[model samples]
Target: MRPDEILIIDRDTVERCLAKQDPVALVESMLHHHAAGGTVLPAEGYLAWRNGVGAYTRAIAMLGGSDTSSGRTYGMKLINASVSNPGLGIERAGGFTVLFDPETARPTALVEAGFISAERTAAYTMSTLRVLGPAGFDEVSIVGCGTIARAHVRLLHRYFGAVRRIHVHDIDPERARRFASDVTGRFPEYTVDIHPDVHSCVSASQVLVTLTVSDEPYIEAGSLRPGTFVAHVSLDDLRPEVFEHAQAVYVDDLGLVCDNPRRILGALIRDGRVAVPGTSDAPGSGPGRAITGAYGDVLRGALPAVRPDDGFVVSNPFGMAVADVVMGRAVADLARAEGLGVMVDLLGAATRAGGAA
Candidate 1:
């Protein structure tokens, strides 16, 4: 491949490549690398504004790089979403991921990232479930019935053979029913039930996953049963009290969770209820509550796995960019091997045409 050429991997190719690879294993490996300090993760760049119709729209640019035994790779994922998208018959979030040449810092490939983003987020949930979830859980509940929730259900069906029943709820009852129908249609072995309210679904679950886009906290304390595991994927769905009362709380990254001002945990930190992990006043050290540790810590065996007696435990993944980079790199490598993407001479065209006047 020429330095001036860049591979453009469309959504179809991205999906195909991911199908042939093990996403959960990839996420686990990335988490291990992150825990070992083999990654560079910078603060995400965020921009939000109201559209012409007074609806909220936002874009996020996350940059990350990793140095592993195989090699070093860098990438960025730019995802944008609008609250009004669903009404217009479009997916709420979409974006592309750019993989850069490690040595030259130039673009190597651009892969469709919306699917990758959802898959990685779901993988995070599944990875945490392996360590923090109840053993032999036969049922699971999901709070949002959107794209992310679909990804979660798919991964759950793939990884957890014992989960035979899925309970789902959405603010829109129709959407909930549709999600249930889709799930059952695709996986005939599992039964999907739609609940009219979130609480009912939560009560029925041994493992609960919240994937809604609500900025307000509604899932209050006591919603989860004893020995339940919660994957707070949406970040803002759970009330602060839930975190305050959890038997143990684990996050993808301590600094990332505390740094984001929009999430519940960050607000708790600001209110002085939750202390930053590793500090002298953190939980178990003082009166303030503290996070147990990152899931990476658990994956590396630095932290103990959650037991049935742990009560209601929560794992909040703040969505790391390095995982996206790792997945993008994997897709790019597979695309290259199979010659799946279109190659365009990004820089050579202008140079060969003697520059435009």
Candidate 2:
């Protein structure tokens, strides 16, 4: 296998992969990977996401099909690690879609990425919420109108059908307006409100999902009504005091949150705060649902459900590679099923690739 080879696929391939993905297996694999001394370079974490994406996306646009810019190409590299002897069909960001592994690079397989970002994030969120407590939110206030913000709404919409009303507010009025229109247009049965400002949207909400990448906290704790479940996939979007009054704080990746620039849960973890299932010790699960400071522990009957007024429940995916691998495998199967991937024709050596790894 050569190091310089690249594999590529498109969006349709990702769809097939996700259709048969398994949540439990993926989560377990990720926990094992982290627990097994796997080093993590949180993508957004390492990149310092304040304004990194805005610049990166613009560079990508200028590189692709631009008459004014130089024809020089800037291909984005896919994050990788070899579990089996095989891994990755190359996946270029934006331009070259789908997960593809060139035979030379020894990439495991090409997979679809239809819901790669959203599903994985949602899976992590749901996993934390599942262990943390009940998330039977009827109506939700969403603060932020971006990709992950929309992902939160869509995924929640799938799980909690009772979410009939969504109060969406973005600093960008146009984006907020567009989101409300788009959501209502897609799901006519549900009513969405494009709040002119944050106060009108979040003041009395049961659950507030914050997806903005704000350096300053957008939603203050005093502003939040009692029983408001505040879960910000992005921490700085909400005020630090919000965590103080949180009855329950469910973080998917505790390590990520602890290291977050916002330091929302740093003090709590530092003080070795513990949570008893039924007690209102803030539904903060870390290290295991057992409070070890590892990945969250699983709680079946051991854990009590979320009450009517659990203040905050936040889950951070932190971009675990295992989730990527799990999703990668799913995409591979879909690619194989639909006969979409380029076969590794290493003569008889190709047969040896699967025998051991």
Candidate 3:
């Protein structure tokens, strides 16, 4: 294969090739590897433009680390999120990932990332549950009914085998009903019900996952039951006070959180209202001290959740670049092995040969 040639894997091919547990396992290994001091993740680049109500675009770019366990590979994922896409009967988020050969610094493959993002997000949630979730739980609640929420439901059903009930809530009642119907048709073993409100949906379940796009905090403080594991997938759905009241808070990366201050927890910490985990004199002090550990630490068992009066254990993953890149690399490798995707001269002919651009 030529160094400048790129493998192009589209969304349909990725959906077809992804097995039931591929993303979950890949995300688990990457998190463990990252915490083991084998990965390098720089601060993510972010750009957002606001047009008007229900109109905006957010572009994100970040490079993930080399996968030493899988032959020194690395990648970068670029995502463009348009809030109005769904109104046009399209996916709200779309992006592409570029896998690289670390040794040569040559781009290896370009893969569609919208589906990959959902899969990785779901995988990350399940991975966190494996370490932080209460054992032998019966019910789980999800607060949003979108593509990512659907992925989460599928993963939670697969991982939380003992949970018999799934309560879902969405601002759009029709969407919620549709989500419930789809879930019921797919997984008949579990009972899928739609709740009219977030409080009822959250308070009733042992595990609560929030994926809403609410700009303001709708997850009221003191509403969640003690011992509830809340996975806040949407970065800003919960109030800072919610974190202040939680027993413990875990994020995907401290740097990512600290950098994106607009994120609920990030804002609290960045404004000095909440201190970073290791910097505090007393753990869980004030509103700013809630963030005590990262998800990687949880996976390493370095940070254990200590229940305090049945308060919530909040796990916040701000969607890492490494997760997307690693998963994309794995899917790209699979496509290569099975003779999938189109090989195109993305960089044109090699510059060394003086091929005119």
Candidate 4:
């Protein structure tokens, strides 16, 4: 590729490239970089509007830069999420990432980000699971059967090794059954059961992951067994009372949790139901109160492990923008190495023709 040209990688290429990448390692490294404080990550930019069909649509622009082994890499992702796009028979999420030449501020490549988002999101959960999950879980339950659920199912198995049983439940039974069948076919050694109801699916499992889009909570506070590790992959699936059941609660970003539009945890805290670790209100609170901190603290050894007797461990992660940029850099490098995208001088040609006017 020419120095002034930019590579354009489509979604299929990104999917193919990511399949060969180790998501865990990539995200782990990204988190470490994030925690180590060298990366430049600005607050994400977001906008919401109504589409032609009156369906809600959202767009996100996340930007970040960090020094890599090769050099400093910067990237920004533009993501559009059409909440009701299922009516149109296409995936609801789509986006593209632009990696830049740090010194020249020239575009390096534009790669699709839908798969990257899914993989990195799952990777973030896996990283937290490694730090906060119980020593071992015999049976795990997944409460959603969508894109995030599939990523979680595959990564949990790949990273944690085999489990005895994986119970899956979805509002749509057909989706649950289909997910169960597909996972069963792929991993015959583990039992993949499809549950018709949420309570039964979550009640006895040692680990439970909720990945639904429910605006209201469905998982009761007392549904999970003691010592269960819960990954709140989606924000609204669990009720506020669920915090009272957590022995420890970890979040990716405390600020985001306390202020985002879907500030479920923040609402609970304001109601005096949830107690953060360092807060004055936390002390003297009764059992089932949460001791909250960032997962990075756990990784950095600033926070101790959740004891086996800690009752229930929960983590709610509001993903970081640094992750998307880091992943984009990796994809850009891979595309360059494999010669996998189209090259074009997006603005250089026009600028050169325009001269100094």
Candidate 5:
């Protein structure tokens, strides 16, 4: 409560926190955090950029019921925000946030779902990139320019060093050029160029990053150069056949992807256009099991990268609330230890409520 108390957290500080966490560990941490009676709030929001043609705002929340006795917390998370990210080439405006707390707990500090959204979303992307090997990227293509896309460019540079010749593209040409100029003016090590067309960028990029809000697909397999890899940050960026002949379907979790893969894969399996590699025992089944056995197998070096002829390579991640809970709790602890967050006067309130349970 004293003026001497300070809350020291800046973008750089958050970046440091994020830099230290790995994607696999982040995912595992979420699983553990959930197993440790943690929770994730809900997320809902929209996206609109460069034009008044699109705009939306909505409310979304989550409820967490933690059972310390059983050492587990069973809960649900949902999105109520409907605004899509402006149709920037690389960002799809998505903003539905969830707040989490113990089964019988009082609120002392309320974290802004907006910041949490950016934090966790970046965590997932960086986590995957970290796992995939940061140096794997030699040339990078960012198709959309927005908050998250900017975050990607900044963080990737911070983590992997300047991507050789950064390529920027978007439906908004002016926005794309501005993004180049702004980011170039900000970080001088990399040369930023604005591409008037997606094809030129995609064809030359080895590591392509796309974030878009358009319901229509922004990426097409026909354009990707051979041997190039992609890190798709947006959940709904591709169409049905984008992965029609992918050599590898990399994912953070095989089970999660299997349960609810992207619309492209989800629709293909559901409509019989394509089959999930591992689950099909149906007539058209060709392989003995799925392409990659699972995350464990991939970790154990069992799953090989898709060969050149396979056509496409992909990475899918469906974030877990439990992971959000862990990072959130860690941030909360950091806030507490540093006397950062707003403190509540619990005092004898618990005593008045018949003491602590």
Candidate 6:
């Protein structure tokens, strides 16, 4: 393939490559690289509007780059979601990731990002769990039964062999049942129990993962048990009081989370309910709750892992674009090596036009 040609990796190819790759390791490397100041993560671009059917829809553009053992790579992920897509028999989220040449800053590849995005997010959750979750647990709870929930369960099954049972609760009972069926069909060694409500699921969980898209916070602090690790994937599921009472709260990035005032954690910082990390009134020093630190600190041994005494720990991963970029770059490399994906002469037309002129 020529340097000017751009490789187009479809969803199927990306999935095949990811199945053979270890996303958790990739995400861990990303966290470490980011911690070492080898990444550039700019503020994410966001836009939201209501659709014609009165359903909420939003688009996000995340730009980031990283320097790793593999090399230097930069990219942006543009993902969009509509709440009504599920009702229309379609996936709720879809997008693409574009990787650029590190030296030339020209586009090199376009990879389907919906699956990569979900997978990397799940990988991040698993990586965080290794440090913040209970040391040993057999039961885990999931609050939503959507695509993201499925990704998390798949990773848990693959990595955490101690988990034998999965407790799940969804607002729609049928969806929960479907999710359970899918899990059992793929991994028969596991047992899945569908709860009637979130309270029952939370009460039975050693680890709770929320994957809903609710605009309001519903999971109360009372529902959570001591030593429970909550992976708050979807930002707005947990109430403000939940954070206020948690043993410790870790985010992907301190500045990124506090800068975005739309999410619960950011809103708390904006409202003076939570103290930003590295400030004079850092978490635990002031009347308000304090942020423990970013996950990178834990990875780098700058912060301690969650202990048994740390009750109801929370990890708010304000999804980092660097993770997506690294994952996409890895998949692109794999595709290139295996001679997969289509290579398009993206700049050929322009080059020819210039020559004619």
TM-score of each: 0.94, 0.65, 0.90, 0.87, 0.69, 0.94
Give model 2's TM-score versus the native structure.
0.65
Q: Report backbone clashes per prediction.
A: 0, 22, 4, 0, 35, 1
| Local accuracy of candidate 6 as per-residue lDDT tens digits, 1-357 | 457878888899999999999999999999998988989998889899999999999999999999866899899999999999988877899999999998788888899999998999999999988888888888999999999999999999889998999999999898899999999999999999999988999889779999998779999988988889999999799998988888899998998898888898898888778887766554442257789988988998888887435468999998998999999999999888777887777666432211222
- The residue pairs found clashing in candidate 4 are none
Candidate 1 positional error at 101, Å:
0.5
Model 4: CA > 4 A from native: 1-4, 270-272, 275-277, 282-291, 307-310, 347-357
Can you write out model 2's per-residue Cα lDDT over 269-331, one digit (the tens) per residue? 444344323334444433212222334333323234443353554443344443554455555
Off by over 4 Å in 5: 1-28, 31-108, 133-135, 253-262, 281-311, 344-357
Query: For model 3, what is the C-alpha lDDT against the true structure?
Result: 0.79
TM-score of 3: 0.90
Tens digit per residue, CA lDDT, model 3, 1-357 = 577788888898888777633678888788878877778898778899975674878998888884644666688999888878767778778889999877788888889998899999998888777777776577888998889988887777767778778898898898888888898899888798888988899888778889887778878767888777888999688877788777788888788787877777777776676677768533344545547777777677787754334677788888878888888877877777777777777656332212322
TM-score between candidate 1 and the true structure: 0.94
lDDT of 5: 0.52
User: What order do candidates take by lDDT, descending?
Assistant: 6, 1, 3, 4, 5, 2
Task: Please give, for residues 194-294, the per-residue lDDT of candidate 4 as tens digits.
Answer: 88889999885878888877778778777878878888888688777677767778886666666665656766765566766666664333342655787
- Model 3 misplaced stretches (Cα beyond 4 Å): 51-54, 281-290, 305-309, 347-357
- Misplaced by over 4 Å in model 6 are 282-286, 308-310, 347-357
TM-score head-to-head 2 vs 6, winner: 6
| 51-169 per-residue lDDT for model 1 (tens digits) | 88889999999999987545898999999999889888888999999999887888988889889999999999888888788877889999999999989888988889888999999
